[model samples]
Target: MSVAKIALVGCGPPSRRWHGPTLTELSKRGAIEFVALCDLDETLAAQCGEAYGVPHFTSVDEMLDRHPEIMAVDIVTGDPSHHVLAKAIAERGKHVMVEKPMAITLAGCDVIIDACQRNGVHFEVAENYFRMPKQRAVIDLIEKGILGDIVRVRYVDAKAQRPFEQTARIRGLTRPFSKFGNSSGMCMDMGSHRLSQLRLFAQSEPIQISATVKRYRHSDEFISEDWAHATIEFESGAVGLYETSRLGESLAHYQITGTQGGICDHQWSHPAIPLRLQMGEEWKDVPIEFERHKVDGVDVLSRIVVHTDPQIVYVNPFREYAIDDWCVGHAAEIMSLADAALNKKEPEYGLGGRKDVEMAMAIYESSLNGSMPVKLPIAETTSYERILHEDYEARFGRPIDAK
Candidate 1:
């Protein structure tokens, strides 16, 4: 197999904790030629480069110019930088892999798509939740008719206020929710991942959405919503309820109810707590077995087996590397970009990332219009999107789509 020569951008916390080590491990295992690291912050780039044992730079242009062999670039930056950086990278004739919400607004996403199409480069969005081993097993079970006809998919994150409170205190609740920040809001941040999972679990397209987004605790300075509730109507007649709050009661509930059976879990993707299936009158635990081996003094997941009828197993393609279950998602993401760049094939989740962003935008649009149901494919730019664009221009002194 041909290894992709890739460079990474953004040396922030996510890069240090996840992307840096994951890329290092993959490179050590001969998966990819991890070329270099870049960030606007020279100190951060240098720190990550030293830790990962790679050259570092503060400019994307300089990095690409210096390492012309790098075929794809992994962008782990904030939501606001996604479109700008992706467009620039694609224009330079390199494939792009950007962290998700693909872009903060549909127009921004369109900018990226247009740039990549014009430049003849492919791009993949780093939405990794549904790519995990356990999630893959769950999806496989659903596809195999273990859960006949998914009827409802629900995700509720109640009372997760402590982390949000700490963030507010550190960043100062008085800090304005700006366009250049790491997060757009609750709905666009974690909501993007949950929305993507909901659609995948139902195996259907969302047709309409009704939602209410509000800020109960934070002051006006925090323009983003702290609480959001969205009801999605899927094309396959499946219903999806997504309720999350940075301030509220504490509970994590994720479930998929089908005609024949149901799957329930307290947390979203906890492999430790075996998934419960309700085929009969009572709920039974679906046994999960984790296969692991030592790699470079680290216990990496070799594969995960879900003991369902006939058995559902997800073998780690990168088991030879030191990748834990969580990093498995990240590894899959990088490999997706590599496949697209080297094989001249579409990504596993190519345009699906845009759909995820559209879903979140629909929820916000519905809330902006008094919880009115907003139809899918959005048709045009939303008022909420206009607000975001205006905010971007105000903060950066240029339009979001400015070259």
Candidate 2:
């Protein structure tokens, strides 16, 4: 079996923590040829290259020109660079996979989509939450009709600042939040993932959104909202409520309600919290099992099974590579690109990433307009996007669409 030849751009924290190791492991397993690494920061690029034992370059054009064998590129850079990098890589006739939110703006996402289309290359967004074992199991159960018709989905997160501050302190970063640039506040950052999950859980497309976004703390230094609440109405008649805060006590709640049954969990991604299901006026603990095996001294999840009347199962395709559950999402993303590049197949989540961004943009647009409801399939450049575009031009001294 032939493997896809792949390279990576961006040697930032995400690369070092997740993408680098996952790519190296995939290469060792003969899944893909991890060819090179690139970053504007030469030192960071060199460090990542040395760690992954791959050639490195400080320039994207130089890397692509030198390593023409690279069939695909995984972009793990900041949100602002996604569009520019993806377009350039696709124009070079290589498949592209970008990190979540696809791009900071709808216009940016369209730039990527148009470039890939003109170049006849595949494009994928690395939205990994729904690919996890537990998430997969839940989706499988939903598909099997165990949950019946989805009626409502809710995700609440509180005290997000605790972890954010801890990570910032450890990294020794003192920069305040910016209105536009590397980060677009909590809504677009983590909210993108949650919005995608909510859509998937409800098994519907968002039609309307009403939201309020506010900043309670760091008013002097933070230009973006630290608290956000949104109510979404989906095409399937399902409703979703999302609330998040960077302040307050730590708390998490995720629940999916359906016509016949529902699921509730207190924490996100904690497998120890057994999924509880309500059926026939009784709420009971659903037996959840994780199949595992030892590989390279690591206990890797092989599959996850949810005990319903008819069993629902999610078997990890990369279990043989010894990828743990946490990195399983990353492995799946890489393999998704490999499959798209080598087999000429569409990615598992091709344009779905754009939909996630659209949802987030709706939330922001609604918030910006005094919590007025916003409709889907946004027809024009949003006011929120216009402000970001102006900010981009002011900071970069170039129009966002400039080549």
Candidate 3:
């Protein structure tokens, strides 16, 4: 079988923890081969390349030239650079799987979608939550009319302690790839997962998004929002509430209600934990458990080997529990991508080229503009594209071809 050549951009944590291993495993399985590793930092490029046994390049153009058969680009760049790199990939006629919040702003997202559409290339927002076993099970329940008509949803993704204080510095280790703060805030950083999942659960497009964003203290290190709570009105008449913060340490929680019954999942728990039926009597936690396998071969006994003695075996994917998080849904996304690559069937995750960045922009715009209820399905000509085109032309002193 011919190997699918891929260029990996942004050597961040996701790249190291998720994309890197997945690609390596795919390479071992003859699914795809890493042709190049690109990063702004020469050392990181060299390190990642050496680790993966792929060539390292500080310049993407050079990598493309050396390996013109590149079929895909794995992009994990920060928000500001996402569009620029994605646009380049689209122009080059390469499939792209990008990490969310698709683009920093609405217009940036439009440019990406338009370019991909015109280029006839596949674009997928690497949203893993939608593919999680428990989450998928809940979605299945909802789809089967088990929950009946969806009425309301409350999603709270809170941490027990301040995230910035604990994880910000560690996260900033990848700052060289892009402006860390550009997409580091709770709003775009973590909120995207919740919002995207909400849309999937509702199985309908949102009509309007009203958001309230704030930063209690100023930090030059990061420029993105720290805390945000958003309200969304779906076209199906489902009202949703989403709250996120770099500070919430109590619990990572989720709850959804319908006319018939309700479902809930708490921190470090399974979506199949319990199903409560609103019978004539009362709501009770029905004992339902689904065997959730952590895809990265993680188990209770593996902890000592991975943490206490790292040199004894391969790296443990569950160091911070994010291993289970990514492993929870990685197979779904990978299988989906593989199917699209081989069978020519559109996968649910951007298989038809859904404009996720457009949705993201709508959320950002709603937040930026005083939380006014902004309509969904924003036009392709968003303000960022308009304003940026002008700025680009002015800066270059020539008409710019954004397409």
Candidate 4:
């Protein structure tokens, strides 16, 4: 293939922040050709494509027809439209790379997966977090036996407010709904990354999820959340404690504890301890290129990795770009995908993305059912959105979408 031709579908914030820059970088590397762009909004498609000197279209069908040489379409549409847009491209026998969380519902994910299978095309999701250089190194330590018999993992992601909280506020809603406009709410929105991290480190299929997802204090809704927390039981006899929110104080902490060793994120350890690993007989900092930059004496390394264990760390792609959390894993994701596309390789993120959505759904299910434990593969006739809609009607005496 002479530089696999690719089209980008959906020009949203994420598309601009991560996808566009990464794809452009790949094009510069001569790994792929930016053939065309498509979007429901002509203005968005035109602006995005013109910026790259590529053709633009308002419809996927039109773009596909015009660019018959296109080898892949990267779909970054909203959660609700993910299944529809991806299935459309897959049915045309083109490989697809979808943005994270896969879909708003399991059925939607199933449809996209089945479509790709029937059409004989590759299907992958843009799951970036677990792909980070530091994160990958940490996971390797756990997976290799350095961690020694995994026991449990703890992860917390709390954002005081969400992108959509203000939009919901403007609507005069008595309660906050997702700004992502998905029925899965922030649980799936942010929960996708949390669960992916847990699954990656724990290396287990979840057996059960016990948790709660609530919307409280409509007036103070930041990004949108009262609170969300879950405890997951893994099939491998391991456990994970997970929490996330778009309300109240920004904090993130993650750690994987095992019989012999442990690794944690910056937030999980003490100030005296390095953010990487302070393990073994003596707590020495992991040997990283190791530079810390801060504002007002507070540590903030735009994006630096500690070479805690050189054997596990490989050459990181994010460093070449502006290294920060925003650009880190995302650049790695596209870089790996570009290589995979050129080599005719399927990606590692396909089934895992769908499972991430499923695990998030399980967390929401537990919350909806009075904080009881919900078993995996949740055999419920109820969809996650149905519960949210019911709650909305009860709170406002009308359906959630009522205007």
RMSD to true structure for each model, in Å = 3.4, 4.1, 8.4, 6.6
lDDT of each prediction vs. the true structure?
Answer: 0.85, 0.84, 0.63, 0.70
lDDT, residue 9, model 4:
89
Give one digit per residue, the lDDT tens place, for model 1 in 143-225.
Answer: 88877899999998764465445434322112225646888888788899899999999999999999988765545555677
Compared with the true structure, what per-residue lDDT tens digits does model 3 show for residues 91-170?
88877767777765565566677788898776777777766545665676677676778888878876335644533332
What would you estimate as the lDDT of candidate 3? 0.63
Per-prediction backbone clash count:
1, 0, 5, 7
Residues 1-403 of candidate 2 have per-residue lDDT tens digits of 8899999999887788889999999999898999999999988988889999999999999999999999999999989889989998999999999998799889999989999999999999988889877788887777777777999999987644543443221111122234455666777788888898999999889999999887655444666676789999999999999998776566678899877677778867877435566766887788888888988987788878778777777888888886788788899899999999999999999789999889888888887788899999888898888888887888778777776
Best-to-worst order by lDDT is 1, 2, 4, 3
How do all models score by TM-score? 0.93, 0.94, 0.78, 0.80
Give per-residue CA lDDT, model 4, range 4-97, as digits (tens): 7788888989888778776776676565677788888988888998887788899889888888888888888877667777888888888888
240, model 2: CA deviation in Å?
Answer: 0.4
State candidate 2's TM-score: 0.94
List pairs with backbone clashes in candidate 2: none
Measured on C-alpha atoms, candidate 1 has an lDDT of 0.85
Error of 1 at 178 (Å): 3.5
Clashing pairs in 1: 159-249
